[model samples]
Target: MSMVRAPWRGVKTPGVLRRAPAMVAFCAGLAVLLAGCATAAPSGAGQVADQGFVSGDGSVRTWDPGDRDGPVRVTGTAFDGQEIDTDDWDAEVLVLNTWYAACPPCRAEAPDLAAVAEQLEPDGVRFLGINTEDEAPTAQAFERTFTVPYPSIGDRSGRVVAELNGVVPLQAVPTTVVVDKDGMVAARVIGQIERSTLESLVEDVLAEEEPTGDGS
Candidate 1:
């Protein structure tokens, strides 16, 4: 239940965004035409709503092996219509990234994340996005533009974010969380994730020995 919290990060994403200007433009146009995308409401007391968005300081946090909490028991349906339950996944590591279509940091990290996910898939690492905002078309457009290889759960009800907030401070727009084989939150990047950082975090968890059934 204890972790080392370090925050503040930035990444280069102009290049990635440039790769699909038309897709970004299309999503942006949709956002404008739709009035505005639904912003995520905090399911608790402290809600950071500045300019309709609040981004984490891109800091990273890590919990020690013995200090990690029990597994996260969250279930949600992805935009692709696939049912996802953390408890049911059999991967050695899971990466949960919180994002929406218009969030700058989210957009910035998308390509890097997709690449890292693909690179780490053979290591039995899985990637899933938890989007608390955005409709199906907007979310899917970004996915297609970025060539995102994984599914993103539609957390429009904020249920999934609330479930995650119980385990960590999720008061920001783009946060990347790394879960170990035990399904416990092992590490988190509070803002846009750098490709190397994500790789290292997942790799660190992947390197750990499997947990014994009796809690080691």
Candidate 2:
């Protein structure tokens, strides 16, 4: 008697066919992972990483904010006398400019920063000042003198200044960091930026915002 056996019992299909679903899934998952990675940089946003800074024959220092695992925690009073946590301020682009009332460069840049804050308000950017080397009274005076509309976070201990540079030594005043919506540092400018330059940089940052019909 001939035993009836399944015709395809032991025969294997082509490797590609056998693993088609897995391969497809792997490819799909890979695409998703890559997409997530690519989205790290917001579209139309200009990111100036540590590499962008001039090292000046390695004498000029640099820091990788990417290496920073989390947001730099800070607590201070706003110019309006309201307490603020650095994490609580929500905006697409965060401009953190370290200043002191006494520094000439800081004085020079205050108005530019104020203008930037005004121009970017409609575009969902938050411009904040960090008074790293000044007391509250001094900062208040500076704010009043410059007519700074945005809040200034008093960095009495200079920790925020140190953290922003990823532990790199900050030798200059008036350092500015442009942070993306994800709270990652996008660009760092170390010096007084002219009004035109400040405006241009702010425009570049605002350009990254995805337009919404509601002007909220």
Candidate 3:
């Protein structure tokens, strides 16, 4: 009979040396624990109301009504004859208000808008007036008379006013739009916003930043 080597007695076969179920379980548990320890997901909405610039109804609403809608890009020359690019203005919120030197309501609210601008500027809010009807000289004169510190964009084409709400018929003189830092329209105001109302809204928008921490 052929001499047959005795089966290896000391060494175990490959299949016989399988890992223990406990070891596999421990490894899976460890992986899960490590995954759980990773950074938590970001929060949806912060507690602060001011930081929340965009309205729930999907319309940009702000203290100054007569603000523009759609995109927040300010393209063109200001009434002061200064070149204005929405990018250059350093503010988290933009107030785009439409006005005409000839309109009574526009004249009445000019001071209020100016005051709003002065109060909110320190907190990173910009107010831009759009002189939709008047020529450069008239708009300049109006600004001077009202002591409007913020620059006014010249929308002589009536195109910008048409883009805003509550001014479709071209009946309303003062309409405004609030633009969030992302260049998105946050709010729209269709008429004159009282000084107090405008200030409160601006405060609300500014307050939103306290909790969100600049939305970084």
Task: Rate residue 17 of model 2 by lDDT.
Answer: 24
lDDT of 1 by residue, 1-216 (tens): 111111212312222224566446545543342232223332342344465554244667999988776465556777888877766777899888888988876787889999999998988899888876788899999999999999887766454554465476555667788888877789987666788888888888887855557966
Instruction: TM-score winner between 1 and 2, please give it.
Output: 1
TM-score computed on alpha carbons, candidate 1: 0.72
Among all candidates shown, the one with the greatest lDDT: 1
Cα lDDT of model 3 by residue, 17-95, tens digit: 1456644654454333222211111233212224222111112244333342334455667766677776787887877
What does the lDDT read for residue 200 in candidate 2?
61
Rank candidates, lDDT, best first: 1, 3, 2
Where model 2 places Cα greater than 4 Å from the true spot, the runs are 1-73, 167-170, 211-216
Model 1: ten consecutive residues of lowest lDDT? 1-10
Model 3 spans > 4 angstroms off: 1-71, 163-171, 212-216
The whole-model lDDT of each prediction reads 0.69, 0.55, 0.56
State the lDDT at 215 in candidate 2. 79
Q: Compute the lDDT of residue 86 as modeled in candidate 3.
A: 68
- Which residue pairs collide in model 1, if any? 7-59, 8-57, 8-59
Q: Tens digits of per-residue lDDT for model 2 on 7-117?
A: 223333223224657556544543332222111122332333243321111111223435422233445667568776656766777777666786655676678788778
Q: If both were scored by lDDT, which would come out higher, candidate 1 or candidate 2?
A: 1
